[model samples]
Structures are given as C-alpha cells and as structure tokens.
Target chain A: MSNTKLVLVYKGFERFWHWTQAFLIIFLAVTGFEIHSSFSLFGFETAVNLHNKAAWALIILIIFAIFWHITSGEWKQYLPTTKNLKAQIEFYLTGIFRNTPHPTKKTVLSKLNPLQRLVYLGLKILVIPVMVMSGLAYMFYRYPQAGIIKSANMEDLEVIAIIHTFGAFVLVAFVIVHLYLITTGHTITSNLNAMITGWEELEEDENEPSVNDEPVFVTEPKI
Target chain B: MQNFKPILTFLFAVIAPLVIITLALREPETDHELLNQLREKYTHQHKLGIDHSKLAILQQDFTNPHAITAACLSCHTERGQEVLKNAHWNWEREAFIPGRGVTYLGKKNLINNFCTGIASNEGTCNRCHTGYGWQDETFDFTNEYNIDCLICHDNTNTYEKQKGAAGYPVMGADSPDFRNIVGHVGRPGRYNCGYCHFHSAGGNNVKHGDLEMALLTADRTIDVHMGVDGLDMSCVECHPAENHQMLGRYYGVSSSNTQRATCEQCHGSVPHTNSKLNEHVVKVDCRTCHIPTYAKVNPTKTYWDWSTATKRQDGKPYELVDSVGNVSYASIKGNFHWQKMAKPEYYWFNGTADHHLISDKIDLNNLPMKINTMFGDYHDKQSKIVPMKVHRGKQPYDTENLTIIQPKLWDKEANQGALWIDLDWEKALEKGMEYLDMPYSGKHGFIETEMYLPISHMVSTSDQALSCVDCHTRNESRLANLTDFYMPGRDQNSTLDTIGKWLILLSLAGVLLHGIVRVFISRKNKIAETHK
Candidate 1:
C-alpha cells in the first residue's frame, strides 16, 4: 500500500464513451435477440424500433470513440506485441490462483494487457464492421422510391441476418469475459473504481517516467 | 408613410393571433372525413341522366319478358346487341387457358366444387342469365328481343326471374306489374348484381366469403369502400364497364391477369406512411392485410361432403340443422360445415390460374384435387401473396373415365333424372353425360376437392389492418405455411441458433469458474496474512 500512489488513468471523454458504449451494447443485445424471436420482452414492433434507434446511437458513439482514441494517442495502446503475452496467459491460468504478480503493468499509456489488445483489435477491425455493415443492409434492403437503384437492393435477407446474429453472439461473449477480468486488477475494485472516477493506485518507481515528469513512449515496460 | 407603417403593424399584430387561435380551436379532418367528402362529391356528379317514366315507349304493359325486351329495344336499339356479346348473356369468354389453347371457359363449361357444371342444369341455372329462353341448345342466341334489359336496369327492385322458367319473369297474378316496373328502369344497383352474385351456389354467401348480403348496409368496420357509413361505393365503381366488358375478372372464371380491378387503380402502389410497409406493396396484395377475415357478419360454407348425401328419412328427403342452427345435412346436397369471421389462407398468385376442366383426366392418388391451380412462387417477381377462401369439399368423379362427373342436380319436371327430385346419383350422372355427349363410366366415387375463391371485398379500415407481428411472429403466423422464402422473426437457421446458444452458455461457465478460483485464492491469502 505504501509503494503505490493514486494517479489519473482515464480522461473525462474516455470514461463517458466507455460507459455509454457499455449501456448501448447491453440495450442492443436485448432488442437484437428479441428481433431473433428468442423472447418477447419489449414486443416485436417496439423492439425493432428501439433496436434501430439504438444502432444509430452506437454508430455515433463509435465515431466519437475513434476520434478520441486517435487524437489522444490512446490508439497506440492497442498495438500488439509478443512481449509478456505468454506471461499474461500463464498468470490467468495458474499463477492467478497462487497470488502471483501481473505480467503487464496498467498505466495511463497502456490500459490493456496483451490478450485484451488482441481481442479488442479483432472486435474493431472484424466483428464491429461486419455487424454495422449487415445492420445497414437490413435498414436499406428496400428502396421503393429509388427506381434506378433496383440492382442495389438486396434480394436476400438471410445472409445479412446470419452475419448480424453471429456478431451478436461474439459481442456478448466478449462482454462477459471483459467484466470478469476487471476484478484481476491490483485490488478487486481498483479497475472498476478507475473507470468510474478516472483514478487508480499504481506502484510508484523513482526510475520510471511518471505523467508529471515527461512524455515518454514506453511500448514495453520492464518490471 | 412612417405613420401608415405603424398603423399597418398594429392591424397585423391584432389579426395574427386571432387567426392562429381560430385554427387551433378547429379540429383537423380525419382520413374518414376526407374520404367521405370525396365520396359525396362523386355521388353528386353521377345522378341518373334521364327519367324513364317520361318516355312514352316504356308506358305499355308487357305480357312476357321477351315483349318487354322488344319494346325497350325500340328506343335503345343498340343496347340489345351490346348485351348479346356480354359474358353475362353468353356465360363464356374467349380466354387462352395455357395448355388448352384459346378455349371458351366460364360457368358454361367449367366444373365448380359446389354445383359441378351447368350443361345439364341450364333451365335452373339460367335464372341468373340475362337473356330469356335458354332452356336447351335450341334456345335462340341471335334474337335481339331475348335480351332482358329490365333485370339489370330495374331500379324499382321488383324484377326477378322465375325459379326454372329459363330467365323469364314470374308469370300470373303474383307477378310484378310490368307497366310500373318498365317506367322505373335505371342503372344496376348493388342488389341487382348481388341478387345472383351473393347467392351464387343457391343460397346467400355460399360462394365468395368476402361478399355477402350483410355488405349492402355494412358499417366502415365491416367494409370501407361499400360501407353505407363511409364511401358507400357500388360494384360498378371499381368494376367499371367500357362497352359491355367489365374491368374486373375473377380467376375462377377468367385465367389471365390482364383485366384485374386492383387497389392500385384508385389507391396508388405506394400508399403507406411507413416506408417499410410501403415496400411490402410489391410482394403483398392489399387484401392480405386489409381483409384479414371474411364472412364477418354471416357464416359461409366451408365444406360440403357430397358423399354423405342421399340419406332419406323414411323415403322422404329431409334436412338437418347443427347446434348453431346451420344446415348440417340435406338429402339432396350433403354434409356441410360453416364458419364465421374466417381467416383466409395465403397463396402466391401472379393472376393466372389453370382449371381442372370436365373433360380433363385426373389422378386419384392426388386427392383433395385443386379445381383451380393459381400459378406462382416466391421466385416470380410478378407474383404477390394474396388472401383466398380455400373451400374444401368432396365431389363425385368417374372411377373409370378419370373425369369429374357433372350430375343433373336440378330440373323443372320430376322423374327426369334430377338429383333434387329422386336423390338417385346413377340416373343423374347418365342424364348429365348424355347432355355433354360424353360417355359415363357407370361407376362414380367421391374424391376430396378444393376451390380457391379470391377475397376482394369486405375490407376493413386502416385501424383493423394486420399488425407486423401477425405474420412476422414466431408463433401462429398467418404465413407460416409459405416457407419458400425467409421471414425475419418467424424463421431462423437451426445450426446457427444451436451454436449461438452453446457459445453464450460456455462463456458464462468460463467466467463463473474463473470467478470461483479468484475468490478461493483471495480468501486463502487473507487467512495466511492474518495468521502471520
């Protein structure tokens, strides 16, 4: 406890984006499964209407998130490396039960571990794009007014629905694992509290460059 | 100019809010109100042009139906010639039945599930015919005086053909006054067309489920177009006549898609505020949703098992009523089933149908024979899902000839091989076969049959239109049987669904296991620290 110091790990816009995105994703899953006829919660018509509206909200949020990540240099945190990747896996497998230290350090510069970076990168580049594209296809499948765009009309909805549903399953799985891993921080509530209030207590070192000292690019930190 | 500008500004300020308040207080016109206004304007424009009572030619007392037609033809010289060419008079149309190659198909030759064919029963069925003296093949077709003009033009509502007098008016003391009826002729009303149409297979509402006697004075809920409370439209409004040819043609009698009276004639193809709903217009007919159920006020015949006929109560023909007071059984007809507010079955129809003609061969293995096959599928771009009353029944067919039997069901004289008189199937079949000049097999057996009757009337208002969940739901969907194409909520890939559920379950298990291990380690560490 004496070796640690409280520091800001999340910015205001970042926190807002993360929480709003989390709410929207949960809301979308509920409505999306209803559209699949899994169960009737909000009813078919209301669920479809809400699902379409929430999709637009998520798309707008994603644009803001991408802009913030690029401008704040937070995009660099997701760049993958083999460095400590094996150790992170090993820590979760057995070392976690034996009370061993974390393989990767959490700082303002690097928020995700090796495994998290890979998973999130796949989501942004693969899963999310597929979901959004297929969702847009569902929305614009028919254009009665556009007489010239008959060729652009999608003749089949089965393919689009399958792709969208597949992506939904993957997203739900990711959310579950992500929530569980939040407790793997320095303390059980440390990560959760940091996301909420934008501050976390990390191990302080005199040799390490702190946020108040200087701006340094630390791709791989030595423990 | 500055003083005048100030005065103008004061006047404008005073009038603006007053105008706004007046408008705000006045209620906006609903869709029904606007439609009623339009109907009122149309009614005012289409009054009867001439008074027939003022004409000197119509004042004479006609002794027979043919003499009345002759006197009417004196002034309307070309009307009788026009009526002669009409389908109403000839009971046949020059239609191109795909495989048959330019056949005259109609009630004259075609066999229906209800009454079979009209070849041997001309005298009884000709009560609906427009011309007089069509009792047999010897009846005149070229005579202009035989065309009965009073049947369609009689607005006095007293004109009615005798039961089996071959299109003649009832004679003797009980007959209608000819002089008074002749002076009151006008264009046909709803009852004029409905007199035969609504009573098609003998009784009221026996054939088409959407059309019944109740629609004559129906409210807006029961019917929007012909509702006395709403538009109060007539049959001729939609089925307008050019010369003697009407615009609308049913698939039962006519096969081609050329002369359809669709909603698009008045209401355009895209008639919805919701863009998604508007897109469905290309794939779904308006009747599929608007006329969700038919025979709403009265029960319609759904089934008629002719095999159950000929059951006599001590040698006397008798009829039985069901618990609901409907005719359940009769010695002449058969067992019957009726339904009220019946939901329609869906079919993909591109407006062309192929009928099972009387002379055509049949396969007994294919039971529940499709008397009329509506040709289309999901792949056909021209096809749309239409609502229809699929009347199921059993009718006699030849066991050896493999053809449907057209029995002599009615006659003006008894002991002349009429089923209604003797209840003898063999004699009726022999007489009917002799009339068609076709050989009878001497063996008759009942086969299950189905008739597709298109539902075009009794359309409800917009509020009663089918909701999205009605067909798009997983359970009890109206279109559940139409499985050729994918519907979003109703259909799903089973393989994908199974994998999806497993993925969710396994992820849950993985998280729960990881949580348990973490809690165990943390509790163990706390105990060791406290002991130290």
Candidate 2:
C-alpha cells in the first residue's frame, strides 16, 4: 500500500518507563477513586494501603526515569518549541478529523509534537509536582513531633484535600486525551505498538533533517 | 540493562531514609523504673501529718466505731462538732432553690430515681451514712460520738461499712477487723470516698458516669489529673477540706455550702495559651472541651425503662444481658441501655439547678417530667456550655396525685410489702407512703424522667479534646440538637448557597461554550480553505 519500514524510534528504557508509568498512573487513579468513595472496588482501607504503596513506587520510578533522561541526553525531547505549536493545536482541533496533513513530524530527536511538549511540560512541572507534594503532606500529616503526634490543623486540611483532588482531575483529563492521541498516529495502533516494541513505521519524508539545513540554537549548557 | 545500576542506587537512596525514619520513630518502651521512682516520690511527699507513735489514744483497742470517735475527739474536740454540722453527717440541708423558696433537701428528703429514697428503709440505706446506727426516725442526731471519722479519714483500705451494717465497719469473730489497720487513719483517699460515691445506686461506677473504681489506677490517657501516670491527685486536691467541710457541693441536692470548688479555682479564668480559645472560656466550661466523652473505661447506664419489669414464666424474676454482655434487663432494676465511651449531651448551665420535689405538682401536659433541670441559657451572663450525662428512665409515679412515688426497696426485716423481696409495686408504695406520713392516691403509672448529672471527672489530655468539626458540621454534629445560636459550618443559608452554586455552574458553562465556538470557527476556516 505504502513504502513503510520499521525504524528503531523509542529506546528500550523509554518503552519500559512508558508502560510502567502508565500502569502506575492507572493503578493510582483506580485506588484514588476508591479512596474518594467513588464506587469502591476495593474497600477503603485496602485502597488506601494500595494507593500509598503505588505512590511510593511511582515516585521511585520517576526519580530513576529523571536520572536516565539526564544521563542519556534524552531530556532535550521535552524542551518545547513555539514554531508550528498553533498549527499543531489547529491540527488537533479540526485538521486531523478532516484528514488534513499533520503540522509536525516525529523523529528520533523530536518524538513529541510542539503542542504535546507544552502540555507534557505543564504536567511535569505543575500538575504532577502538585499532586506529589500534596500527597506527601497528607501521608505524613499526623507524623509525631516534639512528643506529640501533629496532625494538619482541621481548617487547613480541606484546602489540601481540594488541591490534591484538583490535581487528580487534571491528570485524569490528560490521560483521557493521551489515550485518544495514541490512536491518531499513522495507523490506529501505530503509537501503542511503538511504545510496546520500541519500533515505529515512519514516512520517508519525515526522516531526520540535516544539521546544515537548520541553525541549531543551544539554550543552556548541559548539567 | 546498564541503567538498572544507577536506577537501583537512586531508589535505594530515596527509600533508605524512609525506612530508617519509620524504624527509628517507633514508640520507645515505657520506663517502668522511672514510673516506680515517681510513685515513691509522690508517696513520700504526701505523708500524713499525725505521728502514730506519739498518739496514745489511737493505739487503744476499740470495740465500736463510737469508741474510736471518742478517742479521736480526745485531742480534736471541735472536729466532732464541726463534722456533725456537715450535710454528710446530718443527711439534710436547707436548699434555697430559685422560685421554690427554702426547702430542706438531701439524702433524707430527696426521692431519687435510684433505690427511690432512704425513708422507712434507713437501716440498709444508712450503711453509707456518716453517722452510726441510723436505724429509724427516732435515731439520735445530737450524739457527738455517732460520727464515723474512720469512714472519711481511714487510709488502710480495710475500713468499709457493709450495707445492712448500719454505718459500722465489718466485724470479725469478736472484734472489728483491725488486722493491718491499727494506726493507718489519715486524710481520705480515692478509695475512701469512692467506697460510698462510686458504689452509689447499687454497684460501683453505677450512678455517676464520670466516676468509677477504675480511676484508682487509671493512666494519663484516661484521666489527666487523677491518673497514676500523671498528677495522681487525690479528691481533696480539687475538693479541698477546710474545718471538716469540703468545698465541692452537689448542685440541686445541697445548698448549705456557699464555697463550691470550680475549675477556675485552679486553672484561673483563662487556661489556654490561644487567646481565641481563652475567649471561649466566658461561654464554655473547661470540662466541655476537656471531657469530650464520659465512661471511657466502663460502660454507664444511659436509659432505664422500669415499666418493662415483670415476673418470668417460671414464676421468678428474669434477667437479660445485651449483645455487649451488659445487663440490659433485670426484673429488680428493669430494662437498661448501657453505653461505653458515650459523647455527653451539652447544655448552657450556670451554677444552679432546680429539682422536682416530691411535694411539687407536675403539670399533666408536661408528659415526661424533668426530675432535675439545669438552669441557664445563651443570654445568661453567668451561663457556660457544660457537658452532662442526662440519665433517662421511667419511674413509678402517682397518676392521680401528679407526683413521683417512692417505693421501699430494701427492708431489714424482709417485710412482705418491700419491693426488693415481694416484687409488688403497690404494697411497697403503700408501706413507703405510710412510713413517710404522706397520702397516696392508690393509682400509679410509670412516667419517663431524666436526671442531669454534671460531668466533672475523667478529664482527658488536651490533644484528645473534641475537634472543631465534631460540632461544626452539617450533619451528625454533637451539638445538632442544641439550637441556641447558629454555627457556621453546621448551618447554611439555602438562598446564598444556591446562588453560589449557580454562579460556579454558569462560569464552567461559559468556558465550555467559548471553547466550542472557537473549535467550530477554526474547523469552518479549514474547510473553506480546503474547498478553495
């Protein structure tokens, strides 16, 4: 039908990180909804224990993923670009449904589209961090200090709970959109297959560009 | 796979501290030696004032309680007379209740729900009486030696006046049980006072929900002031004795004493460091917050429906234990509802209480009578929110006379009319009224009644006090029944709440509509471009 070849796009660690992170997030959401008394699948106590354990596991995975990204120089993939960001939003809003050509290309150096980078960056910096910090605060709220087990003052607890719940809602919305986006690749199952097998089918024209074709702008020296 | 090395290291780095902290923060073993040392220190500090070796009168072989009192009076002459004037010894006091004028009320006069009254059954009831041998109405009250000093002053734990003994200690083969208690008389301990107070209404820890025999060895978590692990204070610390007259006074029962012990006496007006909490002291009693719940260790009787009492099919009285193993139904006492760790009912109470006297007429419209009513309100400047155990019951009353009837529960001679022996209510009432010289209408009915007992003891530590949400919540609040004034979180204005909710919904809808329009316009533009 078309000249297509399998390209080694996603690395081994990247695929592992993606699947593990997805499983963890899904598990967290299920347990979290149970803890919130939303159609309890597991009882409240069991859900709480599972949620806490999953949270700690996710935190550990996140920490290791951060180290791996920094070491492998793969952190550059998340750096957002302004060019074609408006076009990428337009593509999602109207063009994709109408069979219009995609605004951005996926290569080894640029796995995420411009709008994806912005959204993913926001999740990493704002929503995820907020959830993690608020969750930790809740977990250790009743930790003992100065011969007294100090609990969060009753007045302030409602605010913390609201912030945590709001973050969870944002994450849930992101996950729904992310699942839909997985089907928007070259084929319906192309993105999912790539994430599982570490290989993707790309158009010949969508190959990496030459260094001399575009001026590379370095932002800051690597840590 | 090479990434696993650094990843594992990172995971180890993060988890090590958490594990270590969790392990290190485990509660340490309690230091029993330190507790023993503290106990020894407390005992040494609170030694009695009297030297037993120097007091020759105390060493004498006493045959009767009166002889021992005579010996005690040999040195302390005014003590006997002073004690004689006390309501404990006299068993009657001039109570000047508001609106009722002055009336003599005490154990002698008041018809209590428990055991009814002391009238006509003085022998069995007078076992708790401070004076000796109060067998009948003709018993001498003016005798100075009749005062049982050993009942209040004995610390040997051996001085106990058994019921049916007429205010005398249990006797051995020939002499009073003087084994190991020859010279141990001192200021009263919790055991001495609890012997009577704790054992009121038939059994220990039965009458007052706040007081129990468990208090003798309670920990700080149970009771902060009286706990062995905390202050270990005796009853006298709060109810200080001066010239043989205790400072504490029962609200409705006793009105003779002007000096009543209050929380402010020790903690001062403002006890809390937080000024906002201290401000609440004006309208909230200290015990309301400090004592969140009552009967922490033992279950207390909350409801007693005496109307349920009847003979069993086997021609004997039946008894039924509840699911929790508490005596729920007894033929003698009737049906009881016991509650453990009970949240107290709150009310605005000043220092005064008005009791329903036996002579007072009850309005037929007021169906269930309030046996004792605590007086206060939100507008009263002297009033504060106080915690109380409102003991509810159904007791026999004169339906025609419109007064609560007293039944002779216990009789020394086992009279056929005695309620405890014969289990006949009519006969017991007839005999009890005849003995008191009061007219009975012969017609009787059981009426619901409530007795208000102000909760004072079993004070928990500050951390265990009620959280704000306990009372300031929309539903199931402790003060849900209290309708004095509006509380913020508990009450909501329906109009304002609806308006606020509608505004939020409108804002959400506006954002959604705006997004929908933008998407639609962008889609139309793209379609037009493609068509061109």
Candidate 3:
C-alpha cells in the first residue's frame, strides 16, 4: 500500500447540513407516515405539525442547498454519466464477491461513481421535484364555493388528488430503501463512520492515478 | 446564467416580498400595543373591550376552518351538538385516550372508526384524536362530541365564555359586544345549515342542500320576512331558548318543543321567499327542497359518505334529468281557486299524471304555430356542442333546427326562475331541479333574447363575461361549470368524496415507480462509490 497525504474534501457546513437533513428527512418520513396511517410515532396532531415544520425546514434547507450548489458548482458533480459502465455493473454482480478490483475509482472532484451519478441525477430531476410540487400542492389545497358544491357536479376533481398522494408514496419508498442501504457501507460502520468523520481508508492500486503526485491508496478525509 | 440581470431582478422581486413577510412575522405583536397610550392620546373615555374582532375571526373560520367543531357551536345549539358528534372531532385526539379513543360524547355512539383503525393496527390513531398526546400514545373518549356543537353553534368557546346567550350573565357580570360575542346569533343563509353540510375529505365541501352554509349566517343579517311567521316566528327563541333550534331533537336539538302556530302567527298568510319561489321556474320550499328519499344523504356522524355525488342505481352520476315540463292538468271542470301557493294541478302539470306530455305556448288566436324555447345542454360528452347561430338575437346561420315548436317548453307560471332551468343556469340546479331566483341582472334587467344554443348553455355570465376567469374564479381552475374539472389538491385516486378519487390511481402508481427507480439507481451508485 502506497502512503498518501490526507486531503479535506467536504466542508464543515456540508457535513452538518447533510446529517441534519438526513435526520430531518427521517423525522419527517416517520411523522408523515404516522399522519398518513402507515404507522404512528408522534400523535396525529403533533405528527402533523412536526411533519409540516420539518417539511418547511426541508424546503428551506433545499433552498439553501440550491444556493450552495449554484455558488460552488457542486451540482455539476451529479451530472449523469455512462463512462466505464460495464465493469461497474460486473463489480456489483460478481467481482465484488470475488474480491475483484473496483471498476470505477473516485476522485475529489467526482465524489460519486458513474452509477451513483446517474441515480443522483435522476433523483434531482424526478423524485425531489415531484415531492416538492406535491407537498406544496397538498398544503395549499382548497375548494372554493365549498358550500355551493352540492348543486354543481363534482366530476371535475379527478386528476389533482392522485398526484399529491402518489408523490407522498414515492418519498416513502425512498426512505425505506435508503435506510436499508446504510448497512451496505464498507465494514457496515465504515460508510457510517465516513459520514460522521468525513474520512475513508482505501487500498492502494499501482495503476491508479494520484491527485497530488502521491500514491493512489492514501487516506482521504473530505470534511 | 442566461439573461442573468433580468432574471436576477425578477427573482429578487419575487423573493423580496417573502423576506419582508418573514421580517414582519418575526417582529413582535403590534396589536398588543398599550391601550393606555391610546387612551391617553384621546383622553376620551372609551368602552375598553368594544370590538368585533372575534366576529371577523369567526366569519373567517366559518369560511375556512383550520380546526373543526371549534368554530361552529358558539351560536347554533342544534348544529353545535351535531358537530360534536361528528368524526371531525377526532381530527386530533389527546393522549389520555387510545390513539383512537373518544374525547367528548353527548349521549351518542362514541366508538370512533378512526380510533378503532388506529389502536389495534397502528396504535397510533390516538395521535390525531382529540387531545392526543403522541409521547405517551394515549387517547380519551370523553369529549368527542365537540364537532357536533362547534360546527353548528360555532360557539368556539365553552358555554360560559360565549357571548349573548340568555344564560349569559346580566350587565353587572358579563357584557355583550362584538369582541365578547365570539359565538352568538346567526342569520339565514348557507352557514345556518353548513354546520354539517359543506364537505368531507369526501369531495368538494359537498352541501346536501342548495343553501351555501357560508352565506347562511351574516354579520349584518338580511331582513327575514316570515309572511306567516311560525307562531312567534323567532327561530332561535323557543327551541334553544338562546341559540336557534326548532323543536323535537333526540339529542341536544330541541326535539319536543312544538311551535306549529308560530309558523302561522307571524307568517299568517304567506311564507318568506314564497313569492320568489312561486315566481321562479319551479315551486319549492324547505320541506320540499330537502326531501331526500335516501338515508345518510347528509349523515353528520360519518367522516365521509362515499355515496354522495353518485346515483344509487348504476353507481353513475346523480340523475338530475328534468323530464317534467308544463302540461295540461285540467279536465273540463277546472276549479278556479283563490289561494297563495297556487296548486300546479289547477292550472297545468299534475305531478302524478302529465309528466310525460309536453305543453305548447298559445298565442291570442289559440294556435301553437311557432312556440319559442330555450332548453340547451351546455356540456355533456354525449351531447354535441350546438354552435352559435345568432348575432345579438338575429339568426346568422340556418335556424332549421331552431327550437320552433320545441319539445321542451319553458315553465310559464313562475317567471322568477323558469328561464334558468330552460337555459341551464346554475342557481336552479340543486335538489332535483329545485330553482332559486337570486338578485341577478339588477332585479329586472335580464334580456330575453331567443337564440339557438345547446341545452348546455344553461347560465350565461354575459352579465360579467369580460374575462373567462371572472365566471370561473369560484375555484382555482375552470371547473366552476358542471362539465369542466379542476381537480382538487391534484389528489390522485381520491376515493374519499373528491373526484377522480381512484379515478386514475394507476397514474400515480407510475409516478411512484419512477421515484423508486430514481432512488434505487442513486443508492446503487452511492454504495459503489463507498466501496471504491
């Protein structure tokens, strides 16, 4: 293993934001489901209020994240890629089990692997937008001329409602799968530790390119 | 980065208001300013608590309730009690009861479906139940009848706190004013009935009756003319003694307080709005207007009744077909009777017999050469849109299919609203073709132009038809009309009373699938990167 100098990749606020956001998302999902009857943690009313507040907080955080990404150009890092894709797929299917080398390497500029890039890109494009739009729609919903509705035919409310609940379920499914994947990290706790301390130890590969003219297998701590 | 300066300015303009609002909200309460300062400034002795602030709040809540039962029971005793018994009471339960436990009960059934669903399956339903404490996960079924009283009486407060009740303390104790009259009297309109009528997650605040509950009560009430007042003619006087409740209610409603003569006492010969009802295209009354043959049509107890807006037969649309037109009900010996509510049978259509036949408009010569008509279908997927063929009443296109000797003749006796039905106006569309003649066209300016339009061209906003939004503004989208749909909350698969409730459940499922794919692909990449 070639020794390499540790370099900071993640800023302090980024980690704080990521963890706080994770905590809030989990809190929101639990309370939201409780409010929706999937399960209950907080009482319905409290869960409603907490869900609302958390949602608002998340919106605020998203606004801030958007600002941060725009300013720092980090959003560009999530651009979908198909580069060196075959080996990446094989690594997950068989190579990882056989202790084969990683198909794609990570760089400071490119924190996400190709597959991760595509997925993150998709989430940014599809999932989050639906959740935000649906949530906003649910909060501000109303039926004007409420009392007069009986006389008028109610056949008009067909499409809007389906979208709101559908968005909610999507967020719900994401939360469920995201929770299970946390255990898939290196050594189970290794990924967890990286999120916590912003550091990860990797094996050195002679064929790998170096960032600062150092051996590729060095300690990297991005915080 | 494109059009950076203009976009920046536009974005700033939008966000500037938000920042200002946030700053304003963050500022301390300005209304809490010392009365001492105002008093000193004027030095004129003023009635300290003189305010109609509560009425404004009451009105706002009645218009849009943040919480149910709390805004209603303040004034109407009967409606208040009904609200208390309703399921909306459990919108949030307290911790003392099962998450699904009852909070307030008033000698009625208290086993809440909401509670039952939550306790065993979730053990979490108690959270939304009344006074539910999420931490301990407990519920109390004691005060569950709150929705019943609150929605009707709109007393928003406990008995002692409400203003203007007869039991309210005399001047030496409690005073009466707008600020204090949190829940007092209600005028006649939709709010008078909206106590339970307006809706559910069940669909667009569905009102069983044509009356707009929000319009029922008024701060400045319109003069109620009980032509032959029911005995003393005081609606809120005897039954509730304080609030309004007609006699004979099993629960909190004034069930056995018979006051039949009161209907005749003040309303001696005529009924209020009777002249208007008689003049309208159809003859109707409260007893007749709300004659629902079906049970649970407006069941106050349930959170939602799925049967609303659906026909009982094929689970199709409510059949609002008006097959009854003016027909000859008289035989050789027609009785010319002197009366107020002229029986329709005496002059024309007998409800029992002449329903199938059509009537014709007669000229002085007694010949039905060309009977003018105006029945048109404005919107039905089945019916074709009959295009405009007339310009300002003069025929522009062929009048070959014009309603000359038309099958559907206008109801003649009642001028107040027949044109509405014949033309398909909105005010006369509820309660199986019951018609209401509102103060449209400034009391008599409505033009009577004969033109060939679809039966669907029922109501014309030619009055204020400048912009499409003006007529359609009642809702967000252009669904103010019967045929167009602006789906509420965009709630997909809205089975609960809302439209498309399960209308297109699969579309949402597709969106969910997309979301799942997005999350899975992203997670896979995250794991791979971690390994690398």
Best by lDDT: 1
Writing each residue's lDDT as its tens digit, candidate 3 over B1-532 gives 6436644764565445445545553424334134344325434322324333445435442321223244433433365444333333433212112232333322121111111112121112222222222112243334432222222332322222111111112232332232333445333223323332333111212212111222233111111211122111222321233222233221111111133212223222233332322221121112221111111122111121111211234532223321332111111111111111111111111111100001112232432221122222323221211211110111111122121111111232333332212332222121112211111221111111221111111111112212222112323322233233332222123343233223334445644564566457768878999999
TM-score of 2: 0.64
Q: Whole-model lDDT, candidate 1?
A: 0.83
Better of 1 and 2 by lDDT: 1
* TM-score for chain B of all predictions: 0.92, 0.86, 0.21
Ranking by DockQ: 1, 3, 2
By summed lDDT, the worst window of 10 consecutive residues in model 1 chain B runs over B25-34
Poorly placed runs, candidate 2 (over 4 Å): A1-223, B1-44, B171-175, B178-182, B252-258, B310-313, B510-532
Tell how far residue B448 is off in model 2, in angstroms.
Answer: 0.8
- TM-score of every candidate: 0.91, 0.64, 0.34
Q: Which prediction has more favorable DockQ, 2 or 3?
A: 3
By lDDT, is 2 or 3 better? 2
lDDT of 2 by residue, B303-413 (tens): 888777655648888789888888888887688888889889999887777777787787768856887778887656667788988888988888898887887777766
Local distance difference test, per candidate? 0.83, 0.74, 0.34
Q: In model 1, where do residues sit more than 4 Å from their true spots? A: A1-3, A143-148, A204-209, A213-223, B1-45
